[model samples]
Target: MLIFRRAKVEDFEKIKQIIKDCGLCDCDLERWLNNFMVAEEDGNVIGTGGIENYGEYGILCSVAVLPDFRNHGIGDGLVRSLINLADRMGIKTLFLFTDKAVNFFERVGFRKTNRSEIQENCPESKQLSSCPLSFIPMRLNINEFFENIKCK
Candidate 1:
């Protein structure tokens, strides 16, 4: 069976490997591992995702699934898990920088946003400052997401 849970320190190397395999950034991963979630199947780490908390704001980063696990809902599950974590942590808004998977994030309710918006809100975010200009910025309003879910 597959399990999703908080990433442990021992899982660090595997998580980083998966992230790198998926063509995502692995910079400063250790600093944020506490906030990461991993998908493990039969004792092997196949995917991971995490957030960079900034008080009421957060940046969802490093969401990745192994190539063999893509399209099996691992990525979606990881993203949903991170979103739930952010909600529970009182994050009001979430942002992300992605050069790929824009449609995937859109399916999860993240809308295209501008870099200036991210800089204005999360001035101290290292990811924001380092993300290339070609990357697309996306935002998700946590409160709105909850409200919409309630309505449905």
Candidate 2:
């Protein structure tokens, strides 16, 4: 069985290893641990995802699932949980940079967006690091998602 929960301080190294193994973006644990979550099974972490707050905008970053565990909805669960966190934090919009898995995030309501949208509103995020040209930008609004879920 898969277990999903908010990540604790102790889960960083394991989660970091998972991110590295999957070739996901690197993150500073000290900067992001509070918003990170992990999927575990039988004492081993199998997946991870996290978010970075930029006030009205949030960055959805570093979601990864083990290769052997793909196609089992683990990645979707991680995204949903991160979205929930964004909603609770009063984040209005969330965006991500991805070189791969664009299809995966699109299924979860992220739509391809102009790079300047992020660059203009979230200069702080761009200041944090540079995104490669190959990485496409995608965005979603937390309130919009919540509204759709309510309608459903």
Candidate 3:
């Protein structure tokens, strides 16, 4: 069985490897390690994701699942868990930069947004600062997401 839980210090290398395999930036990941969530199966870390808190806003980052773990709902579970965490943390909006998986995020209710909007709103977000121009910026409003879920 697969389970999602807060990432532990010992899971760093596994998380890093998964992120690297997915071609995501791993710089400064350790700084926000405490906020990360991991998907573990039979005591092995198969996926990881996290958010960078910026007061009322946050940047979802590092969402990745191992090749063998893809399409098993691990990535979706990790994202949902992180969204729940963001809601609990009083984050009004969540943003992310992704070169891939835009469709996946869209299915989860994130909408594409202009990169300049992210820069203006998330000036202090380290993830945004280091994100490449090619990556698409997306955002989800926490309250709106809950409302949409209820409607469904």
Candidate 4:
């Protein structure tokens, strides 16, 4: 069985390994320390993801999963937990910059959002620092986000 829970400081190493394994992004350890979720099955962290609050919004980041565990729904569970956390925190919008998971986010109900819209939010700036300017930015409206969560 898979379990979803708020990531703690102790989960750091496992989370990083998952990120590195997925080869999605070169993120700092300290950043993951502040925001993330973990998916465990039989005590092994098979998947991980995070939502960095951007003041009025949140940026979904650091999503990764063990290769062998893919297609088993762990990634979707992680994303749903992050969305629920954001909604509870009162964030009305969520954003992300991804290299290859755009279709995954779209399947979860996110749409391509212009960088111009993200630039207006300061919290999003920190998440964007060091990210390639060419990365596509996607966004989800909170109301729609909750709907997607329920549907899932």
Candidate 5:
């Protein structure tokens, strides 16, 4: 059984291990722990994802799943959950900087966005501020997202 829940303080070490093992997140472990939602299976955390607010938009980051647990729908489910969070918060758009998983995110309704477009909406996203700047920015426009969902 898979469970999705807001991450608690106690989940920090487990979350950090996932990030370090995945070699994705560079932020301090505490920062990620404060910003993510966790996925659990039989009480053991198996996956995680979350959004960090950046003015009018948010940054979708720290999404990772254990290697043994990949290829299941957990990551997709976590993304969908954060997308719903962005919608509920009245955020018009959400973006992420990724070197891989573009296809996965695209399949879930995000599209590759130009740097200028991303900076215009979420200039504060770390990808715009300090990251190597090589990461591709991807965005989901909420109105179009809902329209597409309805059409499906």
Candidate 6:
């Protein structure tokens, strides 16, 4: 059976491997400590994603699914779970930098946004600075996101 849960202490290593195998982004232990999720199938981690908390906003990071698990909604599930966690934590906004997965994030209701929209002096802003010009910055307001999802 597949289970989706907030990543725990024991899940960190496998989660990092999943992130590496999928070639998403470097996994930061700090992000996992703050907000992270893992998709486990039969007690094995198969997918992972998380966001770096930045007060009112967060920088979404490291969303990846195993090769064999692609097209099975595992990635989407991770994103949804991250969004849910952010919402519950009183995080009002979530943004990510992605050279790829623009379409995927868009389908999840993340709209294209500019780095200037993010708060200055925050890690999210630093990430925006490091991203290549081709990488698109996307934002999602978790509360409205779920409302839209439920309406559909």
lDDT tens per residue, model 5, 8-113: 9998888878877887764444554555788899999998877777655878888899999999989988888777777777777888888888899888889998
| Model 1 stretches with alpha carbons more than 4 Å out | 150-152
Q: What's the residue-level lDDT of 146 in candidate 6?
A: 74
TM-score of every prediction relative to native: 0.94, 0.91, 0.94, 0.88, 0.87, 0.88
Candidate 3 steric clashes: 0
Worst 10 residues of 2 by lDDT: 122-131
Cα lDDT listed for each candidate: 0.89, 0.84, 0.89, 0.80, 0.79, 0.80
Which candidate do you rate higher for TM-score, 1 or 6?
A: 1
Where model 4 places Cα greater than 4 Å from the true spot, the runs are: 26-34, 148-152
Task: Report clash pairs, candidate 4.
Answer: none
Candidate 4, 1-152: lDDT as tens digits: 78998888888888878888787664455764566788989988888888777666878888888999998878888888888888888889988898788899899888998887777774335657766878889998989766655531
The TM-score, computed over Cα atoms with residue i paired to residue i, of candidate 5 is 0.87
In terms of TM-score, how similar is model 1 to the real structure? Answer: 0.94
Give the per-residue lDDT digits (tens) of candidate 6, residues 41-127: 998889888877777788888888989989998888889889988888778888888887899999999999876776452544446
Query: Tens digit of lDDT per residue, candidate 3, span 13-131?
Result: 98999989988887478788988999999999999999988878888999988898899888988999999999998999999999878999999999999877777877877777888
Off by over 4 Å in 3: 150-152
Backbone clash count for every predicted candidate, in the order shown:
0, 0, 0, 0, 0, 0
> Which portions of model 5 show Cα errors greater than 4 Å?
26-34, 150-152
Please say which candidate is ahead in lDDT: 3 or 6.
3
